[model samples]
Structure formats: C-alpha cells, structure tokens
Target: MSNSSLLKTAVLAGSLLFGTAGATVGEEADARKILGSMTEYVSSLDALSFDFEEYHEIVTTDGERLGLAASGSVALVRPDKIRVLRRTGYTDTDLAFDGQTLSLTDSDAGLFARHALPGTLDHLIDTLRDDFAKPLPAADLLTGGGHGGLTAPTAEIKDLGVGVVSGMLCDHLALRGEEADWQIWVAQGDTPYPCMFIITSRNIPLAPQYRIEVHKWQAGPVEADFAPEKPAAATEVALADYLKGARNLPPNFIVEVEK
Candidate 1:
C-alpha cells in the first residue's frame, strides 16, 4: 500500500470506530461472509509476507494514557515455519520457528535462545501464548481457522460496513470477546486480505488497546525469510535463562514454569 492510502485508511478507521452508525443484521451477515472467504483465501497460501505497524496503549497509575509503537514484518510457510521481526526504539528482536525448534534473537543484546519444539503454525501459536505468554504478530488473522476462532459463543460480533485501510477499501467487523474487543478491516473483492486489526483489553482500566496496520503483502516467502542467521558473536542461551533477564521480550512476554 502507498503512503497516501495508508494515511487515508488510518483516518477512515478512526472515524468509523468512534463515529460510525450502528450496524444492521444484514451488515453482520455480510461481514461473516467476507471474513469466511478471507480465511479460506489465506489458508490456500503456501507462504506469505507482510509489513506491519503495531501500537500499544497503556494506562498509568494516575489514569494517564501512553502509547508505544513498533514496526515489523512477518513471514510464514504452511505446516511449521514462521518468522517475525519487530523493531522498537530500544531493541530489535526476531522469532523463528523451523518445525523442530523455536528460536528467539535479541539482536541488540547479542543474545539468542532456542527451544526444541515441533508443530504446525497453530501449535506454535498455542505454545507461545500459553507457555511463553507471547502473542504472535497478527496471529489471529493469518491462522488457518474460521475467523481465526473469533466466532466463539461468548463473542458479540457486528459489521461496521465499508472503511479504508492502507488506502484500500475494506469491510470492517467488530468482535467483543470476553476479555477483549477487536476490530478488523479486510479488503474487498476477489483477493480479500486483512488490512488492519485492533484489540482493546476490556479487563484493563481505560480499555488499553493494541493496534496493527498491515502495510504490504506478498504471496510467497523465500526460505531465507523463515531461516535464522545466528550471529557468530551472539551467545547461545537457554530459553528460560535468556528470558530471565530479557526486558520487553515482546509486549506480553512471560516465562512460565511447570510443576
């Protein structure tokens, strides 16, 4: 997407989310159809690459809101290969999964960690979220599941009609889950792809949010994208040991110990 389009999309998204009209039943049904088609379309891909900008909102103890931003890219291959790189003001990190092992690199710190794991993309997400408390960048949209498992019984969904995202026209859909409320904008037409996603934490004060804007997409990703390049001078460390001292390993990064 071009810079002009991205600006337009961002402006339109803000207006729609905070100022749009209420949704009708027909709009809701259309949203479901569009999202279902999008899931199918992404599932058929053998590999994919896209650039993303992530934003995080935090509420301070005194009720002041602060925002943080990061930009990154994701590369994925079906079954069991993926890579995500994110750069923030303080650090740059990369996570890679190669079917057999999951590796994380803290480039600025010259530290790397690896864990023995074998699974599909879905399994990797589950492991990261459940055990490591690390959510993959835009995992909900790109995963091979209907609406990325957003159609839960407890979720209240609605379609917010046409909106722009990354300068592309999109169908906006909102979902209120038990813990979070999320909105997604997917491009329309034969190649319906997601352009943006925003999630608000309902359980937190002031409803802090995490927003992601997708800037570009590629149909196929080369092997090098998911393959890790270990720095010769980087120290090899255990996942636990590495995470112990790691700061901001990712927004929700946590190391869990099992009894």
Candidate 2:
C-alpha cells in the first residue's frame, strides 16, 4: 500500500479502538456522584443561607446582547421556610415563605401579596414554577431532591476538572439537556455546595446566558430570618393580580420567552 494510505489505515484503526475505550470511560463520568454528595449535605441542613450575584443576558431585535446585574441573598429552612431578597437598579424584590403563608413584595412599586401555602420547600418550589410561572432564585440547588430533579432530564454530564471560584476550589461539571446547557462548580472538601452556576439557552436566538456567583454560604439560619416585613400601607391584592404587575418585571433568570 502507499505510505499515505497505510498511515490513514492506522489512524482509522486507532480511532475505532480508542473511541470504544473513550465511551467506556465517559460512561463512568457520572458527575452526579459529586452532586449527590452535595445534595446529601444540603438536605441534612436544618437551615441555610447564601449571598449571590446574578446576571442575565438578552438579545435585542438588533442582535445586540444586553446584560443586567443583580445581587441577592437566600435563606432556607428545611421542609418549609425560605426567604430571598434581590436588589437591582430597577427594583427591590423580596419573597418569603413562613411555612403557612408565602408573600411577595416589590418595594419599587409599593405593592405586596401573600398567599396561603402550607407545604415542604420542594412543594413551594414547584408551586412557584407551575402556578405562578415564577422560578425561585437558585432553587435547583435548594430543592429537596437537589440535583436529582434538576438533572433528571439531562442527557449528558461531564466532569470539567477542578477550578477556583470565589477563592474556593471546586469540581466543575457541565451538563447538556435537550434545550439548554448548564455548568456548575461544586465547592470541594467537606462542604460541597455549588459556588457558581451558569445556564445557556441554546434554543434562543442569541443563545443568551444567565449566571449566578455565590459569595457567602452558611447553615443553620434561625426561624426569624424567613419572616417578611410587610409595609403597613402597601396595597394587597390577589395572587393573580399581583402577578399581573410582576409579569412585566425582569426575572432572576431568563424565561424562555419575552413579552
């Protein structure tokens, strides 16, 4: 055979053998192992709190990408109570669930709404998404099943080695779903909390991105932390009415569609 043809044949043989071996190795690359450990730690906590900085990217009709930044804090108490405070240049929003009632307040508009909801934190997370079309900030990490529910539909998970985020070493994981791509950096060592999260809407026009960077994390938050401070003069309305006003506001993460 010609020298060039022999080299091509060797390359083909090597690739076929290596491809099979690579698949075998990739099958064992279950990043879920790390995620499961983190979940166990998170679920075992009676309470938790974290501070985060978040950003959202949007593509204008002119194809220009615009980014917005916001900072927030989250507190969670297992089974029921949770609270979140988010501040942006445009608005100050707070959400609190005290095991019996769920309240939402937007200080920029001087409006507040409360709805009775008695359930676990997981149920609260689902209700906000299904009923109100609102996503609890960084909730995928706080949900009862933790990464389980969030990653159930993911088709591919890859370990992207180790990296440093917010001054802590982390195990970087990348996941690909049918519609989106996500990356998470789980802190290393005894505490495996996720220190960073990024999601890209691959199906969108510009494939816009949303990212959250965690700064502070703590466990065992007190019960009083979940209480919402309702303004005395703030207007109260039905959940639907409250959402009508909120529907125009930018969400913590980008929704599939924009109004």
Candidate 3:
C-alpha cells in the first residue's frame, strides 16, 4: 500500500477498536471499563427534569444567523416538556414546550411563533443531526451509543481516560459518526452528570459548530409553574377568539412543511 493509503488505514483501525489482549497492561483497558460503567449510569435514568442557564450566540451571514448573549432560567419535564425564558440585554424570549407544541414568544418584538415538537427522544436526536452537521449514530449509553425510549447509537467507542470537565471527572467519549468524527464528554467520577458535548461540521455550508454545555442539573420533579405569563400589554383575547384569528392564517401555520 502507498504511504497515504497506509496512514488512512491506521487511523480507521484505531477508531473502530481500542484495547488488545493483555494480562495486565495499559491505560486503554481501564478507559474502556469506565465507559461501560458510565453508560449504564446514564441509561438507567427513567425520567429527568432540570433547570439551567444557557448562553446562546449564533452569527450568520445573510440574516440567518442569530448573535446575542443571553441569560435565562429553563425547565424541562422529561419525555417532552421544556420551558426557556431568556433576557437578551434588553429583550426577552420565552420558549415553552407543551407536550406536542412549542411556543416561541418574543416579548419585545410583540410576536408569537410556534413550532411542532419532536415526539420522541430518538427523533429529537435525529433532528439535531442536520443542525449540527455531525451525525449521532445508534448506540447505548454505556457503549458510546445514543439512548432513548426505543433507540440507541450503534457507534464504536473507546474510553481514553478520566478527564476533568467543569470541575468534575467524566469519561471521554471519542468515536466516529456516520458523516464525520465526533467527541463528547460523559460524566464519570462523582458528579454523574454530562459534562459537555461538541459536534463539528461535516459537509455543510456556513461554518457550523454546535456545542452544548450542561451546568447545574436537578433530575426530578420540581416546583415550577409553566403557565404562559403573557405580557400585560399583549392584546387580550379569549382562546376561542385567538383560535378564530388563527384560522385566517395559512393552513398548518405553526410548523411549516419545508419546500
């Protein structure tokens, strides 16, 4: 084989496999063991609810990119419910999930937008594939795989070692995706939390880079009221009246079918 061919083969071999037969050998063996243990720690979770503060910034070229620094309080009620309230300097946007529908209300703009919610966890994971430009393959949590109600990631993964993230120790998830290579840091040591996840672009335009940072998390029911707190200035109309006005809009005005 040529030098280039040989080099490519070596890298592929490494991504697919990790440890080799040995009586009492290297660091690779231990990392594999921890990845499995951590996977189980994460997969066995039944339902989880957490509150977080996310700072999102997106800068696009043709008015497609959203760039702003914001701080907010968010609440997620397992299976499918999420509420996000953010203050972007002078404006506030509330993103709420009500089982099957998501409401995006711009408090300052005086506009309300809604979208269809993804039904399943696996589907939500798939939805992110296009947005991040990096594929999340099928697998189980313990084996570098995706975990949900009925699906999982089927990627080959090797735990390198225990790495510190956000002041906690976590198992490093290093593997290959369907469209490109990937890396995610899973909680390992004391915290039992997902430290961070990053997906780099594969074959897409607009220099896409997606990173998710999970801060303080509380995995259980909490005292949170998700009732829509509409601004007092918003035109008051009965639900029946609002529904009447909605009928005048285009069919399926909430979530649009991509052309």
Candidate 4:
C-alpha cells in the first residue's frame, strides 16, 4: 500500500470496544467531558509509564482475517523523551527518542537505525507519519500535545456508562469517525487515564480492529533514559533501510483454521 493508504489504514485500524446502546444528549456531553479529562490529565503529567497488550487483525491474501498479538511498554518524559519496546512472535524491537536523535533497533535482525530529529514528542509523531511513513499507535493520547487530536475527527459520541477492565471500574465511551469507530475506557476519579482503547475500521471489508489494553499504569517522575543502548556488533544503517529490512521479517499473525 502507498504511504497515504498505510496511514489511513493505520488510523482506521487503530480506531475498537463499544456498545450498541443509544445515548442521550446529557450522556453524550458527559462522555465528551470524560474524554477531555483524560486528555488533560495525561498531558499534564511530567512522566509516566505503562504496559500495553495490542491485538491487530490482518487480512491475508486469500481473504482470511487473522489476529496478531504483541505486548509492549512505553515510558515517556514530557517535552521530548520517550521509549517504546515491543515484542512479537517474529521480532523484538525498540524505539527511542531523546530530544535530538531517534533510534530504532531490531534485536532479531541485529540491525539498528538512527536519525537526527530535534523537537518535542508531537513533532516526533508528525515526522514518523509524514516523513518516515511509520505508525505510532495511540499517539494522540501518548503525546497529548495537539488539542482535540483524538476527538477532532469524531462525528458522533456515545456514553456507554461503566465497564470493568482488569478489575478496575472505568467509564466507557464509544466514538464514530468518518472511516472508523473507536472506544475507550477511562479510569474514573482524579487521575483519569485510559485503561483500554480500541479502533475498528469502518471502511475495510472485514472491519479489522486494533485494540490496546493498558496495564500497570504509573504516573510520576521517572528516569529519562530515552537513548537506546546499541547492541554490540549490530550493524548501523539508514532509517529507510532498517524499515525495509523489517518488512521482510516473518509474518506476525497466524491463520485461523475452520472449526
């Protein structure tokens, strides 16, 4: 797929959990307020860390839809420092940005890439999408820089009331966009943070979904070590080359058998 298509697919696919219940005006307003609170509270934090479990549905060439799972952890410090580590069945990767430079490493391939991109976390997200044609899932919530970044494209909103995620009670919300539908569960009270997020493609044939569940959320001062440690004997290559090499890795999803 083309870069633009990739971005759209990622955005749409990144858009999942919701209910079919109709919402009243008051409930809609309440839902919007809850989402806004989450944005504000997450953005205001100086540092935070969270573990996430991700599920992505992929359509195979034969038109079979299969699910892929990955787990990762994210650590961020306000202004311009962040580290993301993801592990899948096929590969283990690390992406780090330390204000001045961006580093990506594929431990399985023994290859790494570095680029100079000096700016805030928001700028980093834009560069990744526009320049590098990369997708950072849940980026809006993670960076929390752009106002209404998540809700701006929303066409409708619904309050699904409360739901439990990992045994924690959360306020559930469902949102509809032009090309996607998404849901979020925000933990109630003073520290309003997202406990779970899901995005489902509305335009895609199979309506594939991408889901993220946050676990072990920690907010406060954390070590700002965004620079990734380059593995010994690993080859350093251009960013584009690293991305190309990554595309050749083994498929991350498994095909389901007919029951």
Best-performing candidate as measured by TM-score: 4
- Candidate 4 lDDT trough over 10 residues, lowest sum: 247-256
lDDT of 2 by residue, 125-241 (tens): 888888877878788777533533445667677777789997999988777788888888999999888889888999999899988898888877554556676788678878788
State residue 47's C-alpha deviation in candidate 3, in Å: 5.1
Estimate candidate 1's alpha-carbon lDDT, on a 0 to 1 scale.
0.79
Per-residue CA lDDT of model 4 for 4-57, tens digit only, reads 999988877766333357878898899889988988899899999999999988
Q: Which ten residues in a row have the lowest lDDT in candidate 3?
A: 134-143
Clashing pairs in 2: none
Q: lDDT of each structure?
A: 0.79, 0.79, 0.50, 0.83
Model 1, residue 133: C-alpha shift (Å)? 1.1
Best by lDDT: 4
Best-to-worst order by TM-score is 4, 1, 2, 3
Pairs in steric clash, model 4: 15-199, 15-200, 16-198, 16-199
Cα lDDT over the full model 4: 0.83
* Worst ten in a row by lDDT for model 1: 144-153
What digit string (tens of lDDT, one per residue) describes model 1 on residues 156-254? 578877899868999888877788887888888877778888888989989999888988777775544555767787798999877765567344634
RMSD of each: 7.2, 7.7, 10.5, 10.1
Per-model TM-score, in order, reads 0.83, 0.82, 0.54, 0.86
